[model samples]
Each structure stands twice: as structure tokens, then as C-alpha cells.
Target chain A: MKIFELGKAKSPWILHYNTGSCNGCDIELLAVLTPRYDVERFGMLNKGNPKQADILLITGPVTKRCRERLLNLYLQVPEPKVVVAVGTCSCGGGVFRHMYNVENGVERVIPVDVYVPGCAARPQQIIDGVVKALQILREKGRALEVPPHLKKIVRGREGGIDRESLLEDLRRR
Target chain B: MKKIKVNQEICTTIPMGSQHVALPEPVKLVFDTENEVVKRVSFDVSYVHRGIEKSLTTMYDFKKAPYVVGRICGICAIAHSIACTVALERSIGIDGEVPDRVRAVRMIGLELDRLQSHFLINGHLAEVCGYENIFMHLWRCREFILDTADMLFGNRVQYDVVCVGGVNRDIDEKTGTRISEALEEIEESIGFMEEVFTRDKTLVKRLEGLGVVSKDKAFEYGLVGPSARASGVKTDCRIEDDWGMYRDFGLEIITMTEGDALARCLVRVLECFESVRMIREALDSTSPGEEIQLRVRDNPKKDAVCRNEAPRGELFYYIRGTGKKIPGRVKIRTPTFANIPILPHVMIGVRYNDVPPLLMSFDPCLSCTGR
Candidate 1:
């Protein structure tokens, strides 16, 4: 419990990956770190290598060729990590959803904890999403706090929601 | 009789990329060489063909078309937006001129883009010449231009300023003053840059007589913007077409007869100064008014051809609407594609080591070509 508390307080390092976006979303992500937004105050730093990151911040809809590379990179991030899907494109494949050439969104391939929505999400919203993801990380330890009735539905014999089925349903919708 | 003997067996073809340092964006180049001298260069630019034209036809409604089309070229985003809107305006018969403030602000944004892109290309040229100091100085100065752009358009590179009928953003007194001050500072800095560019013997020697495009050859190859102007050809889409504020502003088209890499460099540098002046002029007299944009009335019917002078060169947008929200056919022809035809002609008979600087002389953006 003490170790979990320390890890939560320390704040996780982040890695930014661009699947196949027009440079629009890519530049805005950098703008978040610039002097104006100064996202560093929250202790989030962009790590070039995925092995060192605790959060994977992905922009752009997943393109065909980038999917394998993206998955390989995702696997490289240490376990119990959270993913923040930034921008409308990554959320629901905003403008590029119907391209037929790309995975609909980042969530299609990866488990995303928070979704920040914008044509390209504003920097403030992106920061808020990351902070919210940190809160989610802290709450996982209190799984026992769930009421008896809800616990059965959540931690059912199958142990909570089947993310794959949920994603499939989303895809159909 | 004595006849010159030549062997075709010795000639070799050299391929430079869809991934090469010479081109900033992805495009493949296959060059045939004879004795290490390039003979012919062919372009293979299908790498990033995202089927943008097809998507414009099927995906976007006419109302949503502006934002979608704006994504075609990040470097020339504003130009695409303006051209599409103009084409739409013509098609729907949306008569009555856009208010003076809208016109002026649009001009300011367009010129700011031109300044940033020109400065960036010039910096890249200096980098290719191995003049790291000039490159750094130019880019550092360019930061100011980018910041100004960010202030004006909300984003630096993709400048989301142009809407369907008018502009998305307006310039109030506060921003107008900031822009004027920034322009003055950049204008001041340009003097020092000019000194370095002119006095640096290494830069001058590297660029002088490199990739010379004679006036006749330039015309024959269909060179556009500063590339053609370097060869003393007077052609600029803004000047020729009189799109928005160009006719009112009375722009002085810059031309040079040297037709070398240095001339092209100088033309772009001078154009940067001219852009600052134009922005200043536009800002001073222009006053904000209501209605930055009018609601799009109807979808275009006949094929509409629109063109503009982007920072790189001439950018053309062709759209055909079939009364549906989406366009029937959308075609984009960028300046880099037009300039690519002349690369082999310039490279042929030139030394192998000189290939990089010569290739980058046009400031090629392969993304535009591939798109």
C-alpha cells in the first residue's frame, strides 16, 4: 500500500506516439510543453523510449502500417500503465474514421483510460485528461470498496467488463 | 573526319528517395548518371498519396469541405482554405465582396505564412551549404514569425484562419499592435541576416552559379514563383490573378536575372521583407467589422479552378460539385510538383557532390506532391 501511494504521488513519465496524423495534432502536442502551456509543472515529461514511460499519449488514427509498430511500442511500456487518447481523431477517428485504410481510433487497438476530444484537443484539456488518468491509477487499489451488489456485476466470475466485447460493440455502433 | 566517341554502357541510374535528405517530404527520385554526372531525374511521388482527393469527394459535406481541404498541405493550409472558399463563392453565386477588414486580415495571415516558409527554406538552404550559424540564426529569428502566426491564427503551421467566405479569426487593436511590433523587430533582425548572407564568402561561393536556370530554360520547364522569378520571369499567381488584396495593395514583384541558387535565396529573403511591409500596411488601415464569414448558400455545380501564391510557389485547387454536399472530384496541384519537372534538367552534367544543395534549391515539399 505504501509503495502504491509513493508511485501515485511521484506522477508517471509520458511517451507521445504519432500513428498517422497530419502534423496538425503532432504540433499541438508539442505546444502543450512550450512556455505558454508549460505542462512540465505536473511532472510529466516526454520520454523518447517507451520502456521508461508509465503513460502512453497517442495522437492520430491508427494507420495500416503503423498498427504493428504501435502495438510493439505499447507492449514495451511497463505494466499497470494508463493510456490517454488525445484529439478527436484518436478518440473516434474524427475526420479519418471512414478512410477504410486505417484502424478507426487508438482505442480500437489499445485500452485507453481517458479521451480528450477536440479537432486537435486544446492543451489544457490534454493536461486535465492526464491528471484524471492519474486519479484512476490511484483508485484501482480500492476495488474492495465497491458495494456487494455492484461487485458481482463488476468483478463477476469473469472479473469485470470484457473490454474486447465492449470494443466490438463500439465498432458496430 | 574526327567524331566524338561515347559509351552508353558507363551510364548508371542513381535513385534518391521517397526517403532522402534533399526533399523535406517523402518523394522518390530516380536519377540516371554518366561519369558521376546526372543525366536524367524522374519523380516517383505516390508514397503518401492519402487519397485526399477521393476523400473530399466521398467523406466531407460542402459545409465541412473547407476544414477537410485545409488538411491537404500543412505548409500551404491557408492557401488551400482560401482557394476552396473562393471556388465555393464563385460556384454558389455568393456575390458582394468580403468586407475590407476580412480581406486585409486574410492578407496579413497569408503574408505571415509566406514569411515563415521563406525564412525556413532559406535556413534549410544555409544548412545544406554547411553554414550552421546562418541556419540557427535564421530559425531563431523565424521563431518570432511563428509566434506571431500562432498569435494570429491560433496555430502556427496549419493557421486555421480562412473560413468559407471570410476569415475564422479577426485582428483587434491588441493583436494588431503586437504584430506590428513583432514585424518591426523581425525587420530589424533581417538587416543583420542580410549582412551575414552577403558577407559570408563561404555561403556566396557555395550557392553562386549552382543550379543555374536560364530564363529560357526556366520558362521551358514551367518554373513558378521565385524559382521562375530568379530567371527574370515575372509570374506570381497573386500578381497575375489579383486574388484578394494584391490589386489594392499594389505589390512590387521581385525579379532577378542570375537564375542561380543565390538568386533564388535572395528572392525569398527579399520577399520576407515585403511580407512584413504588406502586413504592416494591412494592419494600419484595416478595421474590424461584423460578418467574418457568410453561411455557405449552395454546393458548387461546374468545375471550379482556383490558384494562389503560397510561400513555396503556385498552389492550384480544382473542385467539382454535383449539388450534393460532397464534391464530385477534387484535384490538387502543388508548386513542388511543377518544379520537379526541371530537376533533371538542372542536375544533368552537374557534379555528384553538388547534388544535395542543387536539389534543395527549390525548397521541395514532397508531401504536397504526393498528396
Candidate 2:
């Protein structure tokens, strides 16, 4: 509904972090930014800084050393953000699962909203996952606008703000 | 000439990685700089270590080792697989028994892999130099190579074509014709890129005379791949090790004496033309309806070493078999591992701002190093 929220859905800047990937999914993600499969046509730009990113695209099975940094990056992104885990390793640790140094998948460290599955996930699959992430970003934007408990009082109003309902809503909380 | 006095008190220590915009993988570098010029540098490449060598000896058997090693570095998956297969075959005492057709098909796979990997690093190097237009154009042309690879192997990044005894897929006449057509398009684009890389003053200005590794220094540091070749080291596993059909194809090693970032870029661009020619020659030499794969019955009982010329450099694999399905020990020495040690040497006198391009010139693939 708000201008910033609309902008957030329209152009979702991506922050790509490779926990311990083989560079397969990472290159494919880069290919998505290039001419042939350019996601820039949809206003998607890959940003290096986590603070400016709307979505975090992560590849590779999380390694022991990268787990701390991954968490740090996940916390740095402001709220109303989405996490998309690309490649089979990030989804469920495809071949690197149960390895000594790896923590299996990105889900072990952070919450993931979309899982793009492939050994080195193809560019088309990555684009589809990103599109799905945009919808999730829009939904998150809507959810962040109003708290769940205050929704009843905000919607029950006829013409003016009801003091009794507001008071009751506060008491219930 | 006056030598400036060194001052440790004025030098600043700056850490540039683990995660950065200029780097595709996770590699941390600590630079000791005095005023803007670097005095010394050190790097940490353990971030991507997945214990693949340990897993190969303990968890996976010889039959499945090729597929497992293919995941070591996705950029050169075929190279890894071929090296692993060669090691396994040698350990089983069947190294010289493979048919010519299988070798030809495998060579095609490796050359195509080299073509795309060179394009990737060149495009990435241009991007780090702030030349996004050249980067975009180069990658746009790279799609044809990937398409040819996809047509041949049925996968883009992880082409699991190599096996222990032979390769998995054979190129039919129809696919071979299509690949030839694709190579023609790729060659035309490569010509355009070669002109830009050689003549473009701005791109050359950023890379030339930076990170000069003298010929003696290259041999002293034991640099492998294009980084060493750029210094005129004349070290290529394709020639040094007879794992593939490079000898039969009369492979000409590309070398440059400049030993700077520009020379490294030029070596890769020039090598692309050789890759195209090799692929064409391989396609012409091999025919359809030939046997692509051979059956393997013996388990490895001896130690064998296989060296492969990957897109980055020489990829070495040492496998010790204990007359069982699982190997006794599997050790991998990737080219990046050999090339990374030379970074501190190269980055010592360079400016702080030129570190990214200098680092990119080596084409550091930490996944291969750490694995």
C-alpha cells in the first residue's frame, strides 16, 4: 500500500553469500545477472552489502567457519527480508552432506524461504526461485505493516478511531 | 634511485575478505600497507574446506569416486573427474588400455570446460577492473560454449561424463555438427574479445605492469596454470603428464613473458582459440557408434598419481588402493593450492586498490584449494 513497500516488491536487491560452495551455483547466479538471463530487466540488482539487500541468496553447504559469518549477515539485513537457498548443497547438502567440515545446508544456520534444487541449479530455476522470493517479499511487507493483535481494532473502525476498542486491544495484549 | 626507508609504525593492516564484492568465493586476505602500497600480504583459504579427501578414502568407493570428486570444483568438474578416473584406472593397472575414442571424447569435454572457465575468469577480471561493458559482452558470448557442453554432456556445470574405465556419453554425428556450429560462433566472439583485450587502452592500463612475476620468481614459487605460464614457466600438465590425448592432438602450450595481469588475461584469451581448435580436431577424429565406456572388474591394489591440466592449472590426484572397493588414501593437490602461495609474493609491492584485479588474474578457485 505504501510507496516504499511497492518499491520493495518491484526491485529486490540481492546479497549473495557463498558459505562453502563449489562456485557452480554462484556462477549461475551471476549468469542470471548477465545479458542472456538478465534479472536486471525486472529491476533486480545484486548488492554486496547486506544492509542494502532485500533478499539474501546463499549457495553451498554451510561450513564450520562460515556459520558465524552467515548468521552475522542474516542478522544484518533489516526485517521484511527473504532468504533463498540456491543449489542442491544449500537445499539439503546434496553430495557434501555428512562431510566433516560442512554443517550440511544453509538451513542449519538460518531460516530459508525458498529452496532452488540442482547440483548447480540452472539459471532458469534460479530465476523462478527469485520470482517466488519477490512474492514472499511482498507478503512480508504486508505482514510487517500492522501487528496481528492490532488488526482487529484497525479493521473494526467505522469512521473514527474507537477508543474503547483500542483500550481493549491494549489490555488484551 | 633513492630507497625509501621502511617504517613498520606507519604501515596499516587491512583485511579484505571472507566475503567481499570483488571475490566470488570466500577467501580472506590481510594486507600490510604503507601509505597506499602494500608491504606484505597473507591469505586464509580454509573457509571452503569440506574434507573431501578424507571422505573419498573413507566414505566413497572406487566406483563412485569420480562422481564424488566431480563436486570438488564445479568450474572444472570434468577435469576433476578425469583426473580421478585416470588415477583409479592406473591403480588398477589398466592405464594404457583405454581406447582412443574414449580419450577423444574426454578431451572434448575437458577442452569445452577450459573454454568456458577461461571466459568466466576473463569476464570476472574485467568486472573487477570496473569494465562492466566488456564483462557483460564476454559472458554473453560464453553462453554458446555452455550450450555446446550441454548438448554434448546433458548438463551445464557438472558434466559427469568421465568414469573410471571410460566416459559415460559419446558424441553422435548430429551433436558433433551442432557443436562445430557453436564453436564457430564462439570463435567469432573470441576474436572480438581478443581485439578488445589486446588493444583496449583502458583495460590494459589497469592490468599492465601490475603484479609482475619474473620468470625466475615463477619457477621459485612453483606457480602452476596460466599464472605460471604467464611468466614463461612452460609448465602445463597437458604436456608434462600424458593423461589425455593432448600429445596426439599436438597441443601447443601458450606462454607469455610479461607475467603481469594483462599477460595472464592475454594467455587465457589466446588459449581459447587453441581450445576451439582442439575440440574441432577431436570431433573430427572420433566417429559415432563407437564404444564410449569400458567395463572395470579389478579393484585398485597399488598407488597411482594422476595429473591433469585444468582450466586454472595442473590438478594432481594421488590414490593408494588396498585391493578393496575403498581406497587406502586419496590426496588431491589442486592448481589453486600451488598458485595461491605466490599471492603474498605478488601482492607485496602493488597498490592497495589494485589488489582485486591482481588477485583476479590468478583466478583463485578456493573450493578446489580447500577441498
RMSD of each: 10.0, 4.0
Off by over 4 Å in 2: A147-169, B1-8
Error of 2 at B63 (Å): 1.3
TM-score, prediction 1: 0.74
Query: Candidate 2 chain B, which ten residues in sequence have the lowest lDDT sum?
Result: B1-10
The window of 10 residues in a row where model 1 chain B has the poorest summed lDDT is B1-10
DockQ of each: 0.10, 0.80
Best by DockQ: 2
Q: Which ranges in model 1 have alpha carbons more than 4 Å from their true place?
A: A1-94, A100-173, B1-7, B11-14, B20-23, B32-35
Candidate 1 deviation (Cα RMSD): 10.0
All candidates' lDDT scores? Answer: 0.74, 0.90
TM-score for model 2? 0.95
**lDDT, model 1, position B310:** 81
Q: Which tens-of-lDDT digit does each residue in A1-173 have in candidate 2?
A: 47999788888899999998999999999999999999999899989899999999999999999999999999999989999999999998888999999998999889999999988899999999999999999988887786667666777785345888888877887
